[model samples]
Target chain A: MRPAAPMSIKPQADAVQLVLAALIAFALALPFATLKPNRIVPGQPLFLLDGPPFWARALVILALIALATVTWLGCRPSLRIVVTATALMAVILALGSTAGHLPPSNAYARLSPAAGFWLLTGALGLGIADGFARLKPSPLAGLMAVLAAVLILAGLFSSGWLSGISILREYQGRSDVFWREAVQHVWLAIGSLAAAIIIGIPFGLLCHRRPRLKAVALNGLNIVQTIPSIALFGILIGPMAWIGSHVPGASALGIAGIGAAPAFVALLLYSLLPMVANTLSGLAAVPRDLIEAARGMGMTDRQRLWKVEVPLALPVLLAAVRIVLVQNIGLATVAALIGGGGFGVFVFQGLGQNAADLILLGALPTVGLAFVAAVIMDALIAWSAPRKGRGSIA
Target chain B: MTFASRAIPRLIGLCLLLGLFLQPQLFEPVFRPLANTSAPSIYAQAELWSLALSHVVLALGATLGALILAVSAAVVVTRSWGASFLPLSRSIANIGQTFPPVAVLALAVPALGFGDRPTFVALLIYGLLPIFETTLTGLTTLPAPVMEAARGSGMTEWQCLRTVELPLALPLIVAGFRLSLVIGLSTAAIGSTVAARTLGEVIIAGLQSNNLAFIVQGGLAVAGLAVLAHDALTALEIWARRRTRLAV
Candidate 1:
């Protein structure tokens, strides 16, 4: 008889094993989706076996079991990751197909993902995320994965398969409102960020020029930062309302207490810290010798700032833009509480009506938008960093 | 002079918050004019002290939970065998940043059910990233020679972690904790939408009734509490930093 080889299980497989086991348990224990009569109605859970055909049940379970076994038996990280990702895609496909099984005549009938569905998605996601962490791929690798997932989900949405999901039905009913609010959400986030940059950069420069000013300016900003964002928005309301009514033409310009104006101002205030801090740091990073060389070349301070200093500082400023953009995207949701239209309009409406699907209608997109913004900003920062690396050495 | 100046804002904040909680009527003189003629000048739907108490509970509880989970995760990922988790941790931190606390708090209703529970869960989830990232930095950035010396003295890895690494990292960890607590303080206010009895309840009630006084009261309480908490944490962080230096 051949001697069994010594056990040499890899360490990284431990987390994967746990994820797979949890995935299978969730699949077995809970329903994959709920068959709802309508958006607001609580529905019966469709256990994995009940929702999908025999083929899908077998495929999802079999894939998860195989991955679990392979990891337990020990395998290379890369092989495990590819198999995990493929398995993940398979599970997602299986989830979508479950919707197809629903009768078409039941117009308002929809599939709300139950615990089984979410738990399965979460477990598989952890596996793939674990893979990403372990693989240490290029910096853009994670962003690529995000884009790929978006593409796949987008494809699924466009195919009309997902229309049976409760959240989608909610979207179907208010598709136009959804898009408009999404655009408004983006506008609120970006508009405030733009306003902040215009005000913050020069303020940063002024502070950098005067030592005493930096202390006072940073202290004031710190105080602003410490204030709760919602409170700031609320406090601004009374004053802004007064201005709207008392100040001539303020209402014409949409400068009111409760609308986008106060939300915009509050967001801009929240955004200034990152903007000003980054600008200061970026400008401070400019090499003294380089500035002296610019001076020796007969370039005025303004010329040097606009030309040499600005180019080198571009990356840091872009970083600030990224932070502010992502942050404002999130804060803009709160604007809805104050009658400022954004994704939060759906979220708060959903809350008021106790409709989870409606809230998801608002939240899912806000999260997606913020993440996409982050990835794009990361790419820009990476792009800028390398090109400007040469200047730092000098 | 600098100390007194630095102390003033936090002191005033603490006093204001106390007055709001202990004697809501004291602010009546201030808020009366702001109130509409018919409506009351204070948030009367709930006990001001209890709401304040629950808000503290939510923030503190979430911060504690975050501290344990995040610190453990950081400790694990920094280990050689746990290296794979580093990227997962990084992405989580990144995603946490991308998602607003309000959206996160709202999303919890579906999965966790509404009320304070989901609110606590949301705050816990959101609070994790700051502490985790900061803990990772603290663990990784310790002076190399100090580590070498610890190993030279025959300290086991566990001993080194408990006795040396942790103490050195304490200040940074506290700073991270401070950040989480401050963010949680306000985020919990938003949790009022989900039935969490927070300072936000006051503001929401005010909004619903168009009571300017109630809104101002809630807004001031939350802001004051945040400033007070920020100062408290900053002091703790400085003390921890000083302790480590003194030991060395």
Candidate 2:
């Protein structure tokens, strides 16, 4: 990490420059926001200069110029990062303030961040992630920073600073059902993951114990995994409905054709492959001599497995848990397509109505949840790893 | 062994192609009994064959697109002169992989309006990482002695790379392509939600109308494509390994 000598600073064009250039170009050429007369109607694109308040407009122009200058100069990496982050924050604050002050011509008139804003955020997000990786090199610190930022954003919005943004308005409109849907999404994702672990571990163990069964089981699971989530959920409904209507105690057990049951079942089936495959690999990864040592200590096969094998294979198993959790969180969103209530309810609703903000409402939390799940599981997987050079599929 | 290797995929591919094209007619009778509503048993808004074709196009087109982008990027990054780009390229690929495919697909709607175009964009993004990562591994892990001999024979860097590294990496690259293609196929069904004319349309239509027959037909056809694609590529993988002189 030597500081570049001014004379020796060969053009080290980094992602920061690429990102800032993209942001500046987008701000100049594209619309920063859209003003819709109604939620479902296609909105008029509002360019960077079109947002209200001359002072805010001037401030945004200054920020863009500053970003372009830094990018052109190929300055210090840390300074570039600082400027890039500041630019995003300032633009956001400006956007919020502009939206808040807009005098609506109609009751349903709304302003939402458009493609230009997305590009600005996206490019800067990438730049920040890359810059931090090179500059700080502590993923844990980065993760904590992400949490604090999300909390601050939540606080800001709750204080109604950005309530004028259409997406936030959509959230406010459905704030009651929003929590319910969020709960359903989390329940389906985690519940399915828990079921997979409970059922898959023993199944994986059986496959590990016997080669013939392993081939058949793994192949079947592979086939199952290949089915699209919606199709799988669709296919489950008929048989499940039959069971619910005809079989004793099925209704009592909450088995239904098109509700959370089918979605949960499909998610569990989808989860089994990674769970089983990882378990097989993890069990195989355990040292043979250690198991023998346990046997020599007069341990039964069960005792040896419990005392020796599982602990050694734990990290790779946790890797499986991580994969399943992240995957289930995503697939559960599609569950709403099948009458299984989740955030996907908003996504499909948005699509059906052609309401862009509603789609964002559904999509944002799903990605965020999957992201947080991956981060937490990664931390857990790292913690569970033995102090050896063992590799797990994180 | 060779006969079976060729025949297995050919058989599955043949059956799947037929099933994919003729799914509506094939399922009409079964669905007539299954679909209790007064609505038509078969999906007829658009021909099932055309829907299936668009489905295949979305997935395969993306896979091929990802292949070209990732393979070239990986090749460049693995070159001695291009080594400095490896870490950055890997980070880019990693970021693509962390975003779930569905989210990627959804996000595309905001930037690019819905249709096959957005789905294609999402699929291309989703499929890049596996091929890039695998290609990186394949090129970087070339046997040193083989590279040495190629160099000693007075081959130019370009000539040696053309003849040696890529051929050696083909099997791994094919394996990566297989993974990417399988994922794309499975995911293509969801594209119908975005007006992409995929088989997912049948499932969606059925769900809306409360028709079970349409769902089964669509689900079975989509699943059939997945299995056939996997087997076909596995067959290709076997041939690649054999040609590359790896034990198959």
Q: DockQ: which candidate is best?
A: 1
- Model 2 C-alpha lDDT per residue in residues A308-380, reported as the tens digit of each score: 8898889889999988998898898899988899999998888777777898999998988887787777667
TM-score for candidate 2, residues paired by index: 0.90
TM-score of chain A of 1: 0.89
Looking at model 1 chain B, which ten-residue stretch has the lowest summed lDDT?
A: B83-92
Q: Output the worst ten-in-a-row residue range by lDDT, candidate 1 chain A.
A: A10-19
Stretches of candidate 1 off by over 4 Å are: A1-14, A17-21, A58-85, A103-105, A387-389, A392-394
Chain A accuracy of model 2 expressed as TM-score: 0.88
lDDT of 2 by residue, B1-248 (tens): 48887587659767765865776576466779778868788888888888888899889999999999999989988877677566666776765666667777887877788889988988898898899998988999998989899999999989988999899899899989988998888778888888887999999888888899889878888888888788778878888889988521
lDDT agreement of model 1 with the native:
0.85
Estimate, for each residue in B44-75, the C-alpha lDDT of model 1 and write its tens digit. Answer: 88999999999999999999999999999899
Which candidate has the highest TM-score of all? 1
DockQ category of candidate 1? medium
Off by over 4 Å in 2: A1-23, A49-83, A135-139, A388-394, B1-13, B16-20, B23-29, B37-39, B80-85, B246-248
True contacts kept of each: 0.65, 0.54
Instruction: Give the clash count for each candidate.
Output: 0, 0
Second chain alone, TM-score for each candidate: 0.95, 0.91
